[model samples]
Target chain A: MFSSMTISQLRTLLRAREVSAEEVVISVFDQIDKVEGDIEAYVTLCRSEALVQAKRADALLKEGNAPDLCGIPIAIKDNISTAGLKTTCASRILDDYVPPFDATVVTKLKEAGVVIVGKTNLDEFALGSSTENSQFHVTRNPWDRSRVPGGSSGGSAAAVAAGEAIAALGSDTGGSIRQPAAFCGIVGLKPTYGLVSRYGLIPAAPSLDHVGPLTRDVRDAALVLQAIAGWDGKDPTSVQKELPNYEAVLSEDITGLVVGLPKELLDNELDPEAKEAIFGVANVLESLGARVEAISLPHAEYAMASFYLIASAEISSSLACFDGVRLGKRYGEAKDTTSMFMKTRGQLGIEAKRRILVGTAILQEDNYTTYFVKAQKVRTKIREDFQQAFGRCDVILSPTTPTPAFTLGHKLDRPVIMYKSDVYTSLANLAGIPALSVPCGYTEGGLPLGMQIMGKPFDEATVLKVGHLYEQQTASERRLPQKEVKANG
Target chain B: MELSLKEMEELALIARLYLTEEEKKILPQQISSILDMVHSLETVDTEDVEPTIYPITGSGVLREDEILPSLAVKDALANGPDIVDGYFRVPRIIEEEYES
Candidate 1:
């Protein structure tokens, strides 16, 4: 029950002296110990340190000096650095590597007295849409063990869904967080690109990457976002723009709010069930005094193409640091300089290699003008498309992914199909806007379906507010995968 | 957009990755498929559009170049596969070239 409780609920319970932080943390770990074998949600559990931190949080709570996240147990994506902890990014290359410093988000979480339960699994360097690409074990969807929790934030999403962690932090680039949140029945937010600092987050694609929270509900997402959302001197791309108190905007009236449903994103290719769920969200918003209308983002169809080119290009440049000379595991005996670099770098997983090679090819002297530069121009067009769409509405709505959670290994063999999974969700990342995926409804088969709410750049407050309102108005839509489902699977 | 074996090998080298013969044989196809998917971008016309290199709108912050406390040598070398005298130890490439 403690594991199922939201951050807001847990905070009240902690304040009432009804539960100690240690109890909540123990409860979470117990749930993890019970379910992790089946879910494979975590890459490494920080059990000892978490308990130690929980005890300290209890003391702070008692002294009335606690922050909102005091005593809450949260899982971080493996890619985010945790001081002295193995932040492997779910890749074998960094299997034994530990950071000497915590990521900016981790430091903020520590300052807020949150106990970090563990680092959750991810696609190798967050490269894929499913956790199947991880070098470790694949993480199963909590709803059905046979299926995947959509990734590269799959492990973080699954952990929160299964009550393994109260909430988890996940980074999104091309739908990593939102798609997983949709598949797992939770709220996952991709804050505006510059809203959260990227100080120590392992780069998947620097320009597109965003750090956000996956929570049981919108309020918990807001709490976690508040703690970690701010500019830092360490990340130059981080914006100095003031962030509105997300919690304050959640309950604001939506009488005049305009919700745009992008017509292009709702192609007939979408699963009928997902389309119905998304439209159902619009109806709910309409009943709540919000105006909903169809809008167009014509360039939405080109989002995937541009995203792959741009993201891979950035990845190729960012990952050039891992030559095994300074860090990471070396693959073979080094006989010479070229051999040493080549052998060690070859330790990257197949997906990582695929992206790197494609990225390398795109940036090649003969191809740069045709591929890299062209994609950047299309990137500008995509951003402009969203900017124009925003002129007619407060936020845009669409299905987070084409469908609900797919069976694990379904799209692994076909790289293109796997990339298509993020089609509906990647547009926001390309446009550098804020987006949130909230549980809109469920399939008749009982799998979760997600509705994406996207807003203009640096407009996370609006996005969260809209998601929170829809969540509040459509409480019946929220359904958890039965515990017995996992037990039976 | 089709990458030949030679091109794949060249790319692996650029990426500083050594591939087995089997990887080299298969990589051309794998990389080609991904490139074909991304080729859709070439269809879009953006003759007048300026490329967006950085999504975040702001110039880099200027800071005084001041000395600061940094990672300890031991911690820096903690994960290095081979270390010698607090420095990462790699194969003697220069020596090997000279000998060859």
Candidate 2:
């Protein structure tokens, strides 16, 4: 019932009594049961509870005072706490942990009557550029099962791409959300750092993390963003802006809009085909009356070093809470307290240990300024570079990732190479600007390629307007992998 | 690429991970590759730029410094495997100097 419909279409059908919320819910689970074994996109599926929520949504509609998101099923990234749901962040450490309170995003979604479908999988603790770091199971790219959907938001991206849910929530700390969305060919946004409330997101890094929307279409992403964007006393950093008029912004014309293409975004490292597809997108935009221009963001290339030094240093300290003390799974049996703490973290995956160790080292006396603080200074320069570019452009456009999705386990022996895959997406996060990844085209292998649009800080409306325009031109680029597979019994 | 075995041990100790000797052997290459990336930032002129530490700027988010109650001892111990006398119990820590 829902495979071809947009969220707007589904809402219309639901309100018109053309379809029941229960039917849409059943259709989604049928798809999940059909493809999830190979996709591994969902970490926990609460089928019984989801049906109950769907039923409740239907009842509220019947009563005729339904919430804005009534009957829409959405996936929650496992890292976003949902009061009683087991949110493991795809890590062994958080394996059985469930939060006592819902994250602000989840609470807001529920308040708007969006049915919680299930918890999506991710790289453990939202580290790693690929979902291979997940302790439970790696999420396979829906476009090609052998490939990875870029992560640490891979499961949320893959699930939305594969149509397991209408939309999903994913977090970005240094490109987690946008990279996966780009890899999976969906619309995903990482709001300006303080634009969305971060009250319940498990901290991978305190300052860089952002919670945003992932949807099959730009309109749905904007719709979800509208429902959740606001300041909260619970999240001190959340900006107290008026709830965004995202839907109104969707109609804003692209005519005469000034768009910048950074030299770094079109660098020599970008694959020829990827560059062509992105430039092709720019051409289409120009044809629609938007002016495309080239501008230089000199510090753009150094964003990764800046991201790692600052983010990992914070990760080292933020994760110190899991000393087998307050939260997370406990460790090896031993008589002494110190050994238990040691053994517990020892049980964490190799990737986690590496990050924690690197984080600690960067914060050490000799390396703190020479490495970490210098990186922070570079970050300031990058932010200024963006601020200067915004003076010449309404938005910045680029290929979201340098290349398309790569084969899974292709990066196991060489982890740093995987981190480089996020180069294009991380800078927007570091500069604390809103960025969106929209599906642009399919590679010859049937994998999707995406283009990213970044806008001024807290100006998500501008990003949404540009993405909505881009998505309109590339409407038929929507992808589905299940047509080639048999349904589960 | 020049991380000594001793430096890796010290780093691992500070990171709270217990790295085996084999893992320590692999450290220099990993650290070196990362430092290779860091070297690029060294050339950039950030002379007048103040460090952008926090993404969100705020001068004062001060609260009334009143003490707030925390979770009870039982709730605190809820996730612990072994505990005694209101403290999590673990093996005695070793006093080491990374064999310096």
Candidate 3:
């Protein structure tokens, strides 16, 4: 089906006029119609708007000057603003909040002539590792209906995997993008910090949050990244650096490339099957002419703890704007402003409330140095570890998650366990480096396993190149979850 | 490191969130466990290690000091739950006695 085709494949057909953009949109909507009820990946589907954009793309295609992403149906995580569309971060507070403007990435995608299929679900405020924290219904794994599509970008990952959308955008604060991508069996890239602008993203943790693409393959991710990565005047943190053509490096040779496997990251918590998959990927990389070596990131053990403190502290401050008077749902009746604030803010989901409370506590005068500043110092150590590791290798390789997608509700009540699932993925966010998760292999149970490739700051080309080469070598292992979906249906 | 219920309630108050009865009952333990997990940072030696607050290191970017078009009043107030005279309406901050 057209929905199952990659952007690279569709770009050729589209340019050749072999298929109309409307046909592609219709095909995607057909897939969505068939499986959306089962997968529950989308919070909102812009069927009519997507059709309208497809029509515009068809006109642009006829002129023979359309952009690469013309007519590609894509899903956007609901946390990223889309003008005039409800941009609920899966929180009841902002359930009716429609953004007045598009996020920088959204605007960039629109300018590229892509059709936005809809906004996908996410963890409330993008704070949780599982979409179960979402106030909305949980997004089921397309691979196994009984399993969770890893989150907070679970809906975006699941949609791309199920062919509901060709590709989607997800923001990674701490494994929000890569872990879900790993769980859903797709390519998810979190570009180096400052590589992508974050002007209109509802912040979960501003310093660590990164907007990136989740796609069917590495090439599509490169395409999307090429279109969106750059400095934006609106986002002060956006780096003023020249962006490399990400697609240009995908075919480059890795004959002398050095890949490091950090012993510290390969913890006892890693599933035996996942451990085997990591070794399997290392073997594939070595066979493809890349050198693999064991390396130590000594400070890696503290990344999770440091990340939580930093993330929660930032989330508390960022979400303070959602008072009852302005945007978002206003709840309860009160005679005083304090009561008004309490009533409205109290509606936050359990995970969000927990973070806010923890964040507030961490930033308090007595606890600031103990928790917040200390985490920041450890964050420096973690970044220094990556710098040291990169001195000996081109990229770091590890399992994206301890295991593959777990059964739904398995870790919902256990927030700490759910947080632990991000151990392999959160370090990249903390270090502000580029990380990519590509499907490595499958578990005996048919769940997808992911191999993570992390590179130095502003070195997305290297990361994408390594992931692409690995993907090319293991092309046989690439399979969609349609068979399981069909069985469930 | 375990927080008392009273302490948890105070933290919630500081955060401007009203906890439900269940949250009041469970949050102290939940927050305390999370705190314990993050307490691992205390073990790391950070002597003389400068804190890295923002990932990107540099001076902030600045734009020209020129007037630019911004959101219209209508658009700005469009999402407001309560609006009065093109302004956000909120509960009275000053009571009758204070106003006098």
Model 2 captures what fraction of native contacts? 0.55
Error of 1 at A315 (Å): 1.2
Better of 2 and 3 by TM-score: 3
Fnat: each model in turn: 0.80, 0.55, 0.77
Model 1: residue A184 alpha-carbon error in angstroms: 0.5
Over the stretch B3-89, how does candidate 1's per-residue lDDT look in tens digits? 899878888888888777777777788778888887778778898899988776863665568898998888878888889998888
Scanning candidate 3 chain A in windows of ten residues, the lowest lDDT window is A480-489
Q: Rank the candidates by TM-score, best first.
A: 3, 1, 2
DockQ of 2: 0.43
Instruction: Please give the clash total of every predicted structure, in order.
Output: 0, 8, 0
**Residues A104-192 of candidate 1: C-alpha lDDT, one tens digit per residue:** 99999988889999999999999999899899889999988899999999999999999989999999999999999999999999998
Q: TM per model? A: 0.97, 0.94, 0.98
Interface RMSD of 3: 1.2
**Which pairs clash in model 1?**
none
Q: Which residue pairs overlap in candidate 3's backbone? A: none
Q: What is the interface RMSD of each candidate, in Å?
A: 1.7, 2.5, 1.2
